[model samples]
Target chain A: MSRYHTSRSSSTTPVIILYDTPGHSPQPWAPNIWRIRFILNYKRLRYRTQWVEFQDIEATLRSIGAPPSSVRSDGRPVYTLPVIVDPTRNSSRPEIISGPSNIAEYMETFYPARPVFPEGSRAVQSLFVHYIQEVFAKPLLPIMVPLSAKGLPPRSQPPFSHSHAADALPPGPHRERAWQLVKEQFDFLSSILDKNVQDGDGVCVMGHSVSYADFALCSVLLWIENMAPHDGWARIREWNGGRWVRLREKCREYMDVY
Target chain B: MSRYHTSRSSSTTPVIILYDTPGHSPQPWAPNIWRIRFILNYKRLRYRTQWVEFQDIEATLRSIGAPPSSVRSDGRPVYTLPVIVDPTRNSSRPEIISGPSNIAEYMETFYPARPVFPEGSRAVQSLFVHYIQEVFAKPLLPIMVPLSAKGLPPRSQPPFSHSHAADALPPGPHRERAWQLVKEQFDFLSSILDKNVQDGDGVCVMGHSVSYADFALCSVLLWIENMAPHDGWARIREWNGGRWVRLREKCREYMDVY
Candidate 1:
């Protein structure tokens, strides 16, 4: 009940608890969790991250009674990270929403000003974000998991290793093949940005102003920066006329964690 | 030079020739071609369609020195339909642009008003259109080709049947499997639209108003309506809360041919 840290010296703004996955240390780098953080920062929501190790995510979510918004291919409810517990603005029960999109909709609904889904743009912006999650990020899993496992603490790395056991890559040639798949996806994304460049500033994914779509992209970029750095982000940052870097710059204001 | 039929009695307006493929009869049902037509109509440009049989597409394009905008997967130049010849607004040579996106960009550049991209929306809209073309439309190839062949004239049907010989479905079981694949894609699209509906008017693909993305979706919808209405559109039209029908209605004004 005392999850709310009401500091006597500071204003009585309710602090939202963002259940985030820890990277090498306790810092957050998980793409999905970063999506929520980006929105929180963009909307100036007061939130503190409660870091959860990879193996403890399900238990933590269960203890808090937060339900997942998605499921595994086998129909098991996927209890993943990026669950948020937000106390009502007025006096209402605290709300727990699991997925990034769900949390985003909650934010946009509750906090009407500083909107993310501007009028008429949500449909296409959602499609763009879905494509990034379902298609573009898929090919990066093989590369990302191994790199992330290396970056995470020794205690947290085992789960990633075991989880990727079946999807383990063959020694040399398979890594090349995996990177090729990532390159193909990157090339496709570049082409999409190239087309939009003629219409606007060529930096943001949505209209002239940045929206949730840009934040989604920035989350992926931040994941690569933290997990693989040179091996991953360096290889493709200059691609498609330096699109990844420009997109990162566009979302620079929201990338910070206070 | 006299391709311009300027009637002395009527208003002097140059007509653009849209080279389209003839479906079963003379109806134009190709999704890519429909994209260009949507933009032309959206811009209120005066245009006349010159229907060309599939067999004569290469020769017809070559005769007019029109270059294909895309290449086949085998690295061969792809001479596809949906080419447009727009006579200059002034005394410049007529420009022939092939491919839907190219023609759209050309229209926006020359026409310079009644915008489809809408400020800041082009990047995400372009990504949505690309996904429709590259990913969403891929699984439907087998089902669409067979049904479209049924609608084609006797002369055009043979080539389609021969080309799809390797990918031919079996009598009962394979057709069922193909429909399942189609259903899976439809389910994915429905989910995307459902998310967008929570954000805006549950109809158009982009912001509040219809844009090029909606046109892209309508193109595929029109293809299904003409090629396999009962089997294809009937099954998924009502999915995700009648999103397909609502989207179709959103772009109804652009669907008509003058």
Candidate 2:
């Protein structure tokens, strides 16, 4: 098989293998996937993605050595998804790059394109930080607590409705309550975006053009559109610059191989 | 006061910070304090430490239009922590550096003295990854279960026994169960460390010499000694790495200023 990377004449680009679990998941979360996809697209870099379902990451890593998972108390043993392997650096032995944040850092270090984050750009940096916190933590709502105790599927496994659970939950007291929390979160987020836009925050939060920070925030915004429409965040939904629309399109391009 | 890091520098010297809370919270679970302390000790690098106690970090950032805490479904907000602020890059506003893994990446990237983990060294990188997986995850164990329910501290406030938690966990089924679980974790850890030593993985997991990988592992090791003791981990107890010992001496040296 052809290597899943391209390069110029003098240099050989490393093969990038992304081990992902591509399901929409029970709870509808996939920030880890979009992060890698956007970075690769932003830099126009190529990589081969191998989708490893969530259950398999442990078995895959453990086939080599105990996944360092035996040390953890959790029965599931791993956290989150989208493990990446950067095979380009260190030609002798390819490095197994994992973790969502770690993979992004590796990309920034080895494959920097036009420099994504600005120097000491706290104003912009803080926004992406907030976006990460809100998006990842807010959505699952309170279903996880009740659901897990009752032996239902995890929120991340989504299609949350079971025959018994279906009647037990409504988007109102249970789901609706969670959605209300999310709606409030979106209100908080839109205010920040509005303030940044109002200030014209130099461009993309660093007083310049788009960097990784811009792409990172843009991806989170796309999630908000997909997940938090109940908040009626029409401002972000109808915003100009076509950033969100273009981002979703790019996400499709990233997903074509799947 | 002289700023520890005024701006990003072109050299490979990281701007380090020994993050702490007000009162210095005499507990082993203070992840940031131990991590940076461990890195500085392991690398034997000299830099300044900036203290932003819990209340102060909140007060300053909030006065700038940032929200102090965003509510999670748990009903309490998870506030962010100390960033390894670098002045040289990100436009001199101090890029937001959070997470132990991310901070390590920042150090290895900018201040790469003695080559942390060695570029493209798979064995070395894997060791570091293992260290992160085992040690970092260990620190999070307390937070994994409910504090009051499990007799551990709640997320929002430190345990009332913060002064004596390691020594004074009350005797009961819950406490015995927690201690038994902790002991089980230690047994597993001892087995792995024995493999490291017996397999002659040497000073580091990959071979002789403690790089950043060792630093990350050793920091957690130090945290654990403060947590509880077992007969098996005695070998690490007597470790006499002069640089590390010197760094701890320095921590002792700076005990009163804050």
Candidate 3:
């Protein structure tokens, strides 16, 4: 089944355009994009995905006049996917929001209901998101990046190939060491989530409700399941006494492809 | 002047006994104990401080049958302060709660009003508290530990002396590097708190209200101010556009000393 169906009619609510990268499957697979996708689905906003190839990201985003997400060390603007053009405010000239957190903040400002950052939790939630990105996702780059790059088209494989060559570890002691570091990070996160079990059965990063912190983590879990289903996903699904699996189950409602 | 007084009469509400270490001043300066003090003052719980010398911490806690906070590397029990004996549940044989987070959880459980972990935020709040303790406080030990040991009575200074000798950095490039790392951690935290400015002017770690996360951080600020008012506190108070000073001001009501 195609994952490109529109949620609402164009005459009523103008759909937001999400620039995403395509994967082997019909569903979107990028972790950062998944974060925004979770928010978009959770908010029940009318939106459509614009699949941009990895090579065409810079040109496509630049053509749309979307600002650079960050600056490169060598004084060049770095353009990445997961940029959104929201036409709800002004259907003629929509607002372009780049970066995952920036787009999440914009959505919170415009859609005010079913908030991702509930009850002024934007600050601490951002910290949690940052921790996942830095401490959790960073170590997995060696293992996941190469596995992820394998699925990309030949034309879109150059950018990731450089890091994949330098950082990728074969099945050996080094790979085991890499997995150990990732496990330690997971253990730290699991300890934090253990505190919430007393409140209820829900395994969200926040209180009992599903917030952006849960989405931030679940996005990575989705990435792992997509890239390394047999080895990575198999082991991670059972880690910390199946806490990650429970968390992913709790976030299953917001896992809509479109 | 003594910083030792009962909040409520012994007949009405049996006062909670807070085990704390003393500094040069009458006010209790230990960071972990200050966390409980903040919660107690915020909840308006009747409690009194029981000063314990560092040398007598193990014996004092063991005599009252308090459980060890943690196990040391060599398998012996590691006893620390911030142990509380709450008499509200049973006046004759009060319950002892050790460890900062444990005591905070106990307070949130029994005295649910004006909750420190508001709205089921125990999990994410624990992550924030853990970040402060590990990332923020760990680096400051080189600078703050020796300075703090100076304020302790000669009889209570042995335990800290070993670490002070090994970890204390002199006023040179080594100390500057340590401060730089500390500044980077603060910058990261300030960026997190910066998100809450959109909601209001409050400089809390969580929402507009002061939660346990703020107390966890402010407790460190109190330790720094008590130990290194001239240099360490002075520099930190001015960093991040005076955010720390603003946070301290917001927490002024709960820093009742008694």
lDDT of 1 by residue, B63-175 (tens): 99899778889887878878998774652688888888888888987886899887777677778888888888888888887777677666666676666533546559888
The residue-by-residue lDDT of candidate 2 on B192-254, one tens digit each, is: 333234223323433344454444555455444443334213433444433333323333422
A1-258 per-residue lDDT for model 3 (tens digits): 114564555557678889999876676779999999999989998787888888899999999999999999999999997899988789888999999999998899889799888777888888888878977688888888888787676788888767644355677899889888889899888888888776746488776788999999999998988877886889898899998998888888877766
Write down the TM-score of every candidate.
Answer: 0.89, 0.39, 0.91
lDDT of 1 by residue, A1-258 (tens): 012233312345667888987667445788988898889878987777787877788988999899976888989887987899887464367888998988888898888689988776766777888899989999998888777777766777666666653254554888778878998988888777766666667777764777898889888988988877777788878777788888887787776664
Q: How would the candidate models be sorted by DockQ, starting from the highest?
A: 3, 1, 2
Per-candidate clashes, comma-separated = 7, 21, 0
**Clashing residue pairs in candidate 3 (N, C-alpha, C atoms within 3 angstroms):** none
Identify the CAPRI category of the predicted complex in candidate 1: medium
Q: lDDT by residue for model 3 over B123-151, one digit each (tens)?
A: 88888888789776888887887877878
Q: Which candidate's lDDT is highest? A: 3
- Local accuracy of candidate 2 as per-residue lDDT tens digits, A126-204: 2344344545345643533333323322443343343343332444566666756655554544443332332233234
Choose the strongest candidate by DockQ. 3
Report how far residue A44 has shifted in candidate 3, in Å: 1.9
User: Which is better, 1 or 2, measured by TM-score?
Assistant: 1
TM-score, candidate 2, is 0.39
| DockQ by candidate, in order | 0.64, 0.02, 0.68
